[model samples]
Target: MTSPTVSVKRVSECFVKPQHDHSQDAKQPIYLTPFDLPFLNLNYSQKGLLFAKPPPSENQHFSITTFLNNLRNSLSATLTHFYPLAARLATRKQQNPPSYVIYIDPENSPGVKFIHATVDVSVSDILTSTYVPSVVHSFFDLNGAICHDGHTLPLLSIQVTELTDGIFIGGSVNHVLADGTSFWLFMSSWSQIFKSNVNENACFVSRTPIFKRWVLEQHDPITSLPFSYPDEFIERYERPQHLKERFFHFTTASVSKLKTKANTECNTEKISSLQAVSALLWRCVTRARHQPLNSETICKLVVSNRGRANPPMSEDYFGNPIGSVSATTTVEELMAHGLGCAALRIHEAVRSHDDKAVKTQVARWYRNPVVYKMSGLLPPNITHIGSSPRFDMYGCEFGLGKAVAARSGMMNKGDGKVTMYPGREGGGSMDVEVCLLPEYMMDLECDEEFISALIEE
Candidate 1:
């Protein structure tokens, strides 16, 4: 039987520009490093935070209008710091290979698009499910608009979906402007501003955006991709596999055990918590696929390149300071070898991507660049992990209270795409959000050997 249908209606829409004017940088092209250009053709990174609606008796004065007013005003203030986000990407057609660059003309540029919508669903309907309802996807805007579309699209768009008993705040950020780290940083700062205003006496120290693009001396102030576009569709053509998604919650204790077990088997060097979790999902997903023992399987782990840069860039430095390392092995080797063996492979690959290696990767990209399409990046059934549990998603407290749940929109999503978030209870706990083929997800949910481990759900 079909699950209950869900629908949403927009209550209002408006544009919120930065509280301060930044027209001085209007025609100046904002720098887009080699690391940032790759995301130009990709869709915005979409994520949402759900909060429980306060009861009427708790605050009779509370109204959606007032709440949104505060939110919009706070956002305007926050944009003053993250001024780059308020800008749009403009193409330089005169160049031999037309290029895209971020340009901000506050006087004429459209501000961040803000929409208020209401969903016909309950708080329980969203928080209680192991598998998120697909309809929740509508809670966000800019569904198919790629970062390249930022030439005309809002660099950042926000949608607040009001549920009967909760509120889901979703945001779509142009990937060319920020990575997961920068995205969450913006969210956390927005929350702080909102809370500070709600309680006037509260310390309202505004966070600063570390817009240090000079770290990459090789990157030019006027950026352009190594390759020209318009060939080999930039958009993704997903597989025919019936896709399904599920959130796998691992407790701090369970994560510890996974780490301990991985370290014991791969005893040469201690594996990290991230490595263990990635290994577990890699092994289980491959098992569920039930492929031939000889079939090759690969796991691409997305890692931040900031720490690997020369002089080691600041952790708070904004923009896409990201890189990836791939670990490969045969299905037979992966399945027969167990989690420890798989983890060791991942650990070794990660360990080898030192500062020099990261520089080399960036340099190579400078010589030869490929406009990436989400679907074709990896072979079938191969795991590509993005995002991380380390991001402080729960720390975002926007007067409404702590978020009850965290979710990603239907952007950059396809089979084998996994994003990790810190569990609401924190304390080293991890939440692995997995997307896979329906049959594979079913088998994974039932895989006794895999589920036997210490997993919360």
Candidate 2:
């Protein structure tokens, strides 16, 4: 199928000043948790496009131009609450001891970039297609350079694309500043502002971001830290390879069946829907790779620490509040035991994450100071699963209506990476975007068990 054409109409920068004074404490360094160091030298960014239906009338109140203006205005106001997002990352080298911090120099740093574009296609043209369109990348302005010195870049960029029948709101945010959950918080807040009307009086966002540096600093003092990009990590990231991204839909009914089967096989252990679905995907991909039977494989589940913190951190604490939990097993054991065993392993791994474990992990990283090396650890046998099925990606309404479709650009089609989102159909379904080599993807498509488990309608 031919890809849609997207033309950039205009490009401009948007600087949003905070509503309140943060100058007194703006220079203090916001210490990076052990979780944030690995991403320090990486230029990883996430891109998501939210599609909204066309307005009901052509009145000035509902015109496309007015909508864009409202979005920009609300975004500027939203930044007031999420002030750190409008700030830049910097390291103080001239100090007796250099300190890493986020600099909110309103006079210096250019705020987030906002792009205006038009697409020569309809929302249905891209959504109804079998695979995601390549033109989707045009909706985002990704960071192309690899940062080795922790050089600062725009923390966020937003592109609003006008489609033939709808509007596409795309956002690109640096991963070093926030993870998937925090990123969505910003997006959700922007939508709330728009929904509440971009009037001057309605400037406050529903959720206020907590930028207290003391929360993490008290646990681990801010100091000069060395950043390293291992050769293996560099090679893996820079390797030349072509990848395909495909979305597989699993309906609520189908998921229930899988959960039932998985639990029955594991003596009715009451495995969650996420664990069951993850296990199914793990099994399918492992079989597709056709790895040696005795080879050990692992699934790294990205777990959020919002509620796992002692007394629990605020829902809007922000930053990268995440850690990984792994479920490891041999290829032989996984294939022989089927879904139940894999599901049980996943359940155990997820259940292991708690307040004590999160604190202990942070303390360990604080003492060592060396970021964990993830490259070449398990070679092609590791599948890193990020994001969650619980996030309300579809509920992001910008006064028009709920989003009809959403897609992520940071989800690269690497060897073994997968991201899950809540399906648009809205009955507790899931949309699993799988990224793998061409051959393995083909094998997964042909797997009878995997095909049978999907909702065919």
- Note the Cα lDDT for every prediction shown: 0.80, 0.71
Model 1 poorest 10 in a row by lDDT: 99-108
- Predicted structure 2: lDDT: 0.71
What are the per-residue Cα lDDT tens digits for candidate 1 across 285-381? 8888898898899899999988877778777777888888989989989988877898999998998988889878777776776567766765675
The candidate maximizing TM-score is: 1
In model 2, how large is the Cα lDDT of residue 448?
Answer: 84
Model 1 residue 230 CA deviation (Å) reads 4.1
Which candidate has the highest lDDT of all? Answer: 1
Q: lDDT tens digits, residues 147-225, model 2?
A: 2222455677787877777777877776656888888888888888878876668877778877653244365355335
- The TM-score values for the models, in the order shown, are 0.93, 0.88
Colliding pairs, model 1: none
